[model samples]
Target chain A: MTSGLFHVPLWIELVAAATGGIQGALFAAGIRDRRIDVLGVVAIGLTVALGGSLMRDVVLDQLPVVVSSEWYLLVAAAASLLGMALQSVLTRTEWLISLLDAAVMGIFGAIGASKAVAYGAGSLGAVLVGVVAAVGGGVLRDLMANRPISIIHVGTLNAAAAGIGASMLVLLLRIDVPVGIAGPISAVATALLRIAAVHLG
Target chain B: MTSGLFHVPLWIELVAAATGGIQGALFAAGIRDRRIDVLGVVAIGLTVALGGSLMRDVVLDQLPVVVSSEWYLLVAAAASLLGMALQSVLTRTEWLISLLDAAVMGIFGAIGASKAVAYGAGSLGAVLVGVVAAVGGGVLRDLMANRPISIIHVGTLNAAAAGIGASMLVLLLRIDVPVGIAGPISAVATALLRIAAVHLG
Candidate 1:
């Protein structure tokens, strides 16, 4: 019975994990100048998606969320595999990659901020954690790829968009809007912001 | 009198810290892309030197080493400038960058592993911590720069080198080797292994 109510968040989490994984795989295969097999691709992808959250939990003196939760692992892996399959079928388009990156950043930023608040971190700390968490997976991927981080030096509006989106989400929560709506709203805002930036560019 | 004994470690730490910083700056400059500016270069360098240590401390539930010590900041900053300066002079030799990277990796692995062990981690845990600490900073830089992590999925000897070097250091320490010699031995081992891998490559 409890599982019924829990499925919504569970589904979201799984999707989020998969999104992260797919991004990582693309980066490894494309940027790193190597062909990552299915296992390597999946491992890298899932690690990136969950790395930030897992790192955050460990830093906060909790068991890493992915390690402790079976659902997180299963969902993340499934989602990544799904993404890999989709990417295989879909036409390779630069615009699509950009859009997905932006969308993921938005959702992740909200996830980070909300998770921080859930853990009772102060606002400033929450923001820091949120930003890191949102971007953390990408950062790990870039590191593996032997390059500089994308958000920091890239002329793109990545971090700025994420911060703004996160702020709005946190502000809404302070006023008691339902948590469920906040995540998607913030994610959409981030996605739109990035997509618009690219369009305007 | 007591402060003098403590000062010894601090002095050694300064050299290690600076070495790390300079390595970071040079790594950034060596990328052959003129996209990053001075601020980005320095920032990337500094993060590589400090990021892993900070993450280690944060995860271990202790105040970060940078937060507690002023010298860490100073050494890292100075080394970053030195690295940039050195890169300007040394870019003629294409392979020196790799050598510098291996050197930094070894020292960091040793330093990180030793610190983790001191914090009451088991031998395996300490070795793992050390490898992470050594490479963590560079990983951060790569990510920020949107590059791949040098440790994972790159088929490089980075983590393995770190693991072996740190584990040896910890083992020597446990067997009552004087603490003074352990640090250099581990760092040297790490550096040599990295350099040897480059040669084999």
Candidate 2:
């Protein structure tokens, strides 16, 4: 019911959705053993793109932004198709995919935390919501694709990056910092941490 | 926000949650390859018991009842522990587990549809919400357990059963039938269909 709680620029949100969709589609398409059809690939991609926002809205007791906004689905679907088309090229460059994935997660985390704060959720709840929003889509995607959840598995520190970024944003907000300034800073920090974890491992 | 929308006896809801918790724990404990700890089993069981309700509340833009009500979590946790203790005995009886799962899905579907109707959702949305509520927990459980989602895979008619029951409940509610009668009838129909599907297969 509450609109505009996602105070970020529309273009930034679109970029995040596109990034998530592409990564999710690529992940789905790369699964050789499972027989996920074309529709399933698109569904998984949309889940990744829109799922975080949906979960965040639901947690804040608002209508899911993805369901209420037509553009969100359109952008996600388009990006999913593009990702499917480019799966061959995208799969070869693992580093690029990981980098993009981390950035997207950070964006989602910042947005989710900001919205939760706007809704008057406590600091701890906001951080948890942000982490859930960052990783919730991948959880849904992995479930649908019949693969291990990337966040929980002994891989990169996906959740840790989201948590740290969200906590930083919350702390900055408490200090009267503009969301515009805090959001990108948090996102970049998360991206750097995630990239470091992946490279170091 | 809407407290009494469930409209079911407290005992019935407790029974449904207990059944789901036991079945979920048994399922988790039976996974031969997965290294799920006792805590994981408890978590999965709680997800199965309370996930549907949490999802339903979120979709309806209401505060999740699970988080709001201490009783919900307490009952779910207690039932989960009971399931864990009985896992060895329960795993040996597959038919019993399937029966309980079907019944739990039915109860959740009925409760969800009824609540959606009470909350003023359209009939189609109510049915969809009901099915999601019935299966959402299992999807979460499967994702956490790193297993294939049972609803989407080509196996039992899990979502189908929930959808059918939810639709029936909505239709009955439209005819001015009380939720008490409509809910049980729909649940029984779902359970019967599920049981028949299992036996015939």
TM-score of chain A by itself in each prediction: 0.82, 0.92
Stretches of candidate 1 above 4 Å error? A1-33, A36-53, A58-201, B1-8, B91-93, B152-155
Best by lDDT: 2
Candidate 1: docking tier: incorrect
lDDT score, residue B101, model 1? 71
- Report per-candidate DockQ: 0.12, 0.18
- Candidate 2 Cα outliers beyond 4 Å, as residue runs: A1-22, A33-51, A54-103, A121-131, A139-201, B1-15, B18-47, B54-92, B120-129, B140-149, B152-201
lDDT of 2 by residue, A1-201 (tens): 122444556777788889889888877777778676665676677778977877887877786666445477678879989888888664484666677688778889988888888888888998998898888888777767777778888454878888999999899888878888888998898888888778776
lDDT (CA) per prediction = 0.68, 0.78
Q: How much is the lDDT of residue B109 in candidate 1?
A: 72
Q: TM-score for model 1?
A: 0.57
For A1-201, candidate 1 gives per-residue lDDT tens digits of: 001111225566666676777676655544435545554566566667777765666644653445434567566667667666766676673555676678678777777777777777767776776677777787766555555678766635777777788887787777877668877898899778877767775
TM-score of 2: 0.62
User: Each candidate: RMSD to true structure?
Assistant: 8.2, 6.5
